[model samples]
Target: MAEVEDLLEGVTVRLSAAEEIRAKGRRRRARGRAVRVGAGGAALLAAAGAWMLLPPGDRGTRQTVATATANPFRTDGVIQMPRADELPGYARWHWTESAGLPAGAGRRSGPLPQVGLAEACPASFAMTDEPGQERYSLLYTGRDHALAQYRVIAYDDTATARSQVAKVREQMTECGLRAVPPTARESEEGSRAWSGTVQDGRTMRVTVRRWNSWVSVAEVLDGTPAD
Candidate 1:
């Protein structure tokens, strides 16, 4: 009976060793699959990153994303003036024969000269052409033969525009100009504006507005007294 017990123990030990070898083989296969899956995942992430870093083409939809997201009120660091043709009616107005006033005519020190029909401060105007300052102006005539002036002035930033607008307002007040209440229909394009009637015999609707980096002034004669 002792010999039989010893033989059974040896057989049991052999079976256990075979099972251990099979288990090690299964573990190795599972580890190999895990490593392969990890490598595949890493490759996918690398490919995605590479695609994200690709440059956008000139005509690609992404090319306009920056412009679309940009603020319209922002100045492009270039002096921009509204064109005479951009007036209310394309055919109702025509450009004057003259090239318009000098560059610095809008400055406080350089008032616009009283040209034949044009008056100084036809519309309240302020601008600077110092090293970093920029401004532009355009003049037009409506079908009724009334003079219309448009001015665009750029500043270092929105804060500067605001300060400049205030200064112009103070100057206008000191000049004894009368303020006209702006109509609710007036559009300022997300900017600060002051509208008034300059009591110079002929009624004029003058507007001064300030946006992100620009100040714009427009004046139109009402063709009547402001009584």
Candidate 2:
């Protein structure tokens, strides 16, 4: 029995070691996401140089553009997410264009100003509604075309936004679809946002999150198409 106990102890140590190795592998995988080209720094330098060579004031023209409130932006279902550590196109956009902004909203909208995040297009879009009343929609190409991926941002308090969310879910149910019930452990990100899932019997369900009055939905539309 003593020998058996010793052997089990050894096994436990090996299992702990294995767990540590697996955790390290996961960290490495997360950091190495996507592929790196050239020597990293060199590729960035080339990209910077190309950007600088563009016609003077070209950036101002490119950024003043705005995608409509309802037009679908991504046929391919991809949005260029803004990185926390970097400046997005909002810097180039004209914050002075507050013509149709939502109520209580300043000239500046929420953190993300682009609702029509392009899939194949690289154009920048602006949040044009009034302050605190700004509304925007973002779509991403899912794994399948039948799967509908929608991310909507509406600037309003929690109750107002929640009611709208409920209404949207109700409509989805009428179409034989389900706003995927979130898992028990699902968590929120801030005072204004939460994430959930919805499904229509497809292999992939849309995962959605609302953060700081902005809503983001991501899904792969492959197995089943949107009705």
Candidate 3:
């Protein structure tokens, strides 16, 4: 009888030890899991902060940003204008040989079309005629006598392009023109546009967009209503 009691006590002690070990193991596993979860949360927060600091173009994973190094017209010599096919789609367009920059002239100076702005046009933001600058100009006259004049200017850097865009916007606001939604396609590079009618009963649309190293400006004057 005494031997039987001793064996039973040994079994009870072994069972208690086993239970204690299992409890310790469970506690260790719980701690490890908690640690992993905390690390994951911290990583997620860091990633979100980094994304917020990125530029507008970089925040969108699908878009490409234009850089000055990618500009194709940054040469020191004269850059030819884009071909007709390269220009934006219009009902019809034809190149005017007499309206472009003069031979060997890098830049041109002229009065900006009176678009009913309160402030006078700034000469620096006006069209550039520097050598090695890529520029194109054309007039599209529809059958209805509505005319649209388009000009595209390519800058060497995005800073210059953005500065010019800001100036255009300021001019439009000073002129008391109404702001309208942009109809132009979203650019992977960067873009700004303004459209409104002047007091002269003519509507004007200006779009400044950048692609790679090129900044293009399109000025459309329509006798018809705003589209």
The TM-score of predicted model 3 comes to: 0.49
TM-score, ranked from best to worst: 3, 1, 2
2 or 3: which has the higher lDDT? 3
Q: In terms of TM-score, how similar is model 1 to the real structure?
A: 0.44
lDDT of 2 by residue, 100-199 (tens): 3233211221223221111211121223333354444332222223222334555567565555445434433433344454544333221122222223
Off by more than 4 A, model 1: 1-98, 101-117, 121-131, 143-145, 178-185, 191-199, 222-227
Clash tally for model 2? 22
Residue-pair clashes per candidate: 0, 22, 5
lDDT order of candidates, top first: 1, 3, 2
State the lDDT of candidate 3 residue by residue for 45-139, as single tens digits.
99998888888766454443332445443356644344544444353433232344333322332222222211122233345434334455554
Comparing candidate 1 with candidate 3, which one achieves the higher lDDT?
Answer: 1
Question: How well does candidate 1 match the true structure, expressed as C-alpha RMSD?
Answer: 11.8
Q: Candidate 3, which ten residues in sequence have the lowest lDDT sum? A: 111-120
Which scores higher on TM-score, 1 or 3? 3
